[model samples]
Target: MHRSPTAEAEVAEELAEARPDLVSRYAAELPGARAAVLTRLWRALAYEPLPWVAARVTDGDGLSLRLVDGRRLDGPPADPYATAAYVTDVRLDGRTYDDPARLMTDLGVPHSSDLAAELGHSVASLALSRAGQPTVPPKEGPGADWEWEQRVVDGHPFHPNCRSRPGFSVTEQLAYGPEHRPLVGLRTVPVPAAECLVSGGWPEGMRDGERLLIPVHPWQAAHVLKRVGDEGPVAHPLMSLRTLALSGEGPHVKTALSARLTSSVRDISVYSIGVSATLSAFAESLASRTDGLLHFTRTLGAVTADSPDLAAVLRESPQTYAGSGERVVPVAALATTDLPSSAAWLAEFTRLALTVGLRLLDLGVALEAHGQNLLVVLSATGAPLRLVYRD
Candidate 1:
């Protein structure tokens, strides 16, 4: 999947021709990548629920898990709250296995080869991200909100394929990936209002008489939409590459990006488009009861052409909550920022987050309040004031 359609044939031909030691180099890179993925997988096997896991034993060093096949896997203790974990070698049935593929082979599990290949991809992707790290260190302070997003090289704390992006060549990764901090140019297609299903009230500015403007990611336009025209305005790429924020200040646009990012291929479903306005209203009403401690962005508009791959959702940017000088930072990027990490600051943030999240859940709407979906409005002195939750 790393090769796009244009380069797929070239790569296949290169593989067929044994000119250099490309195969040997790839073989050399496999062990390190596999080890990194296996460490995360082992942590999941130890902490998360897996039917094949027969039992678990905890000790000072780490956790030991017994699989259904009577084989044992041991790794360092898992700290779910921690972002980056130091996972090196895993012990499997008294044998130390650094390569995930080898360990999976020893386990004799079904679909082991497929899973191993995925792990390899993850490992390779992580290495590329590391290599692309900013040569010059970032400025002393949290210079910009987008910088925080770019600093998140190590993605998900637990998932093995956290950085895995199939079908994205190295060049594409540099150009479009949020970690690379590239300003991606969106493509716009104006669809007549009569031809598109409109919900949540399409913004008047984006509407031209009876026609509505729909923005599409360039990759989506080329690969999935199968049509490209009108180079739209550029925008800053957020942690979620599919979402973009216009320059100066405006709404955050969620475009339908047709690609596998991490685990799921992100596509704007027709179901979401149909209920966007109603859901936004319901969410705002629920959030209003929280006494300003929480804010859920209003869905400004949603438009779709009766297709899953072609849709866009516009919502209020989280920056709206911050006052003149206050800053709103994504929770996921907090670890990479220079914001105050003192105990008191952390406790206040925890209280603010829990109060808002639990209250929303109590109100019958549970938000997927992960790092990307959550943002904190910090005072000039770096105090947590309020929380923002967005889809």
Candidate 2:
């Protein structure tokens, strides 16, 4: 396997030539980004079941981890939910270090090298993400749900590789990253209707006579399929970069993006398409048992050309569940709004989410209710009312 330059080096090189004006800002935000990523890494070390960690010890000196390699790592008391960059440094084997990547490298654990590289990318990408944002968030949250999604500058809250987009260049990140707020113009590849295995109703607009047009993310087109196709609708990239919110309030398009983001390569598998209709029906049936407390966005349609590299899934947006004067917000974007500050509001939201989640769990269906998949419907007064879950 070949290795590329460090993420910070790559970003610096790109910005020096193409975005010189942002060079200083990106540099300024690096420290905070490092701290942010370090915080997540610390939390994972303290809690997650990593095989390399043989034992965990916590006492007056904060948290300590004894690695399987006979080395010990120490850090400040970990707060699983703290968003602030309170962790600036930690001690590993009596040596003080600040960079999460460097610390991982020094640990010399199995696959630590790969994880270290991702941690480095996470730090650099996170800095770039923060540099692109306004210093202060808007006093009033945007009306559109997509706008709220963009406000989540950082990616996964707990993953060490939160902002690590392994294959995306800085240019591509700025162009397709939701936090950058770019209008992504999607393209469509027409496949013979006979060759496609489709579930539900494939829209007429996405068809040309006997061919079904599959929406393709630009990244996938240039890098994976290596062929350009007809232009489709322009859309806003949501939290999941492969999924986009189409113009004219159309269904959200989940295109095949064969890039490694965080943990996995995001490609729409054919197996998923094969079972999409059944899964959607099952989810709908389960949602009906919630008595209006929970809703699952219907998977409108799914099509695959017998390849994970070329597939698409169209689903009703969570916004469709919001009634008049109410707004549907992804749980990830809740931090951008003022509702989380209120003790009463947090309690209410927690109660609503747990009720729906546990109810479905009792029925033997466990939902991946992560911040991105779980959404909340807020009343006019910013009170969390109902819960929405989607794939």
Candidate 3:
């Protein structure tokens, strides 16, 4: 059931009494939050390959889909790739459903209740992101590479949990969400050298008195690792919130963040820790055959407390490829910026991405070359220079 505006204010007031800080934020976030939920629900209805969607077609004004129960659903034209907002309500069998959660409940689909809760959280998170000042990078101005990555205010293009952060609090999201552009103070834990399984080369600076100091994400340190020591290094959070650029240079530290962000909970697997170095070396060898168009960020080091919940991987930042006056932008964020929407530029970027992706596949590695994992090194004038692939 959708909460009325008065009901929403009452709830906010109740929360504000305990938090105090939430009073202003709650009011500021509500409108954006509702719109986010509507967008997510619309995405799920339009796409998602649901069994209930018997057939789908498009018309002049919008889209039309037939349900298994012979109910007709209609809405505005859906552009899954575009981040622009869409109408919040859709007509279901000539009846309008104002909220997506209510629509799902009426549809009686499996896992409807659970999904409704997740959708609610997604709305709240999106509202928080939209309420804050968006961090956009200048077209050709001097800015850190991370700043460009952080400019992706919208979360995912198609998934319903685009901005869903189920386990993160509002304060945590403001401090660590990549869109917030927060410089996180990473803490390190001293694990006995023999007790830790390591891959690749651990930095000498991470060692102290016969112990290997393993970096932990602050969130993980508080909720998962729970053995945080001194504040080790300051880092900027990347598009992937789990990974942080050590001062936007050198290597990125991917720490375990045990929460449902976007679609799923991301944690460093024990298996990945075991083979990080080998995989990095293998990827490097394959990248050499791409004729310098591809650069695989090497896994500099990986350490685990013999637990998937407590792990860290030090990865080379993709910024290494960009020379002076060149810019490295994540493909997802690039879509948000003005990158000269010319046929030549699009064709060039497509060719470069496909060439590198296919080359690696021929060499026995299939890259998950989605927008998030794929990046482009662009010339000052927006010419596609090279491709950077990361997991």
For candidate 1, lDDT tens digit of each residue in 1-391? 0211222233323433532334344344444555566667776666787777899988998888888988888888866654444566778888876655456556667677666555555766665555555568766755566666667776776787777777676556667878777888888888888999989778777777888888888888888878895677688778788898876677789999878877788889999999989988887888789999888878899999878788999889888888878888888878875554688888888889888878877877678888888888888888889988788
Highest TM-score: which candidate?
A: 2
Per-model TM against the reference: 0.85, 0.96, 0.88
User: lDDT values of the candidates?
Assistant: 0.74, 0.89, 0.78
User: Is 1 or 2 the stronger prediction by TM-score?
Assistant: 2
Per TM-score, what order, best first?
2, 3, 1
Put down candidate 2 lDDT per residue, 1-391, tens digits, no spaces: 1122378888988878767878899999888888898899899889989998999998997999998888889899889888788889899888987888888888888898999999999999998898888777678778787888888899998888999998888888899999999999998999999999999889999999999999999989999999998898899999998999997678899999888788788998899999999999998999899999999999999999999999999999999999999999999988876778999999999899889889988999888999999999999898888998889
Stronger candidate by lDDT (1 vs 3): 3
Error of 1 at 257 (Å): 1.6
**Residue 299 in model 1: lDDT:** 89
At residue 20, candidate 1 shows an lDDT of 36
Residue-pair clashes per candidate: 2, 0, 0
Question: Which residue pairs in model 1 clash with each other?
Answer: 1-167, 2-167
Write down the worst ten-residue block by lDDT for model 2: 1-10
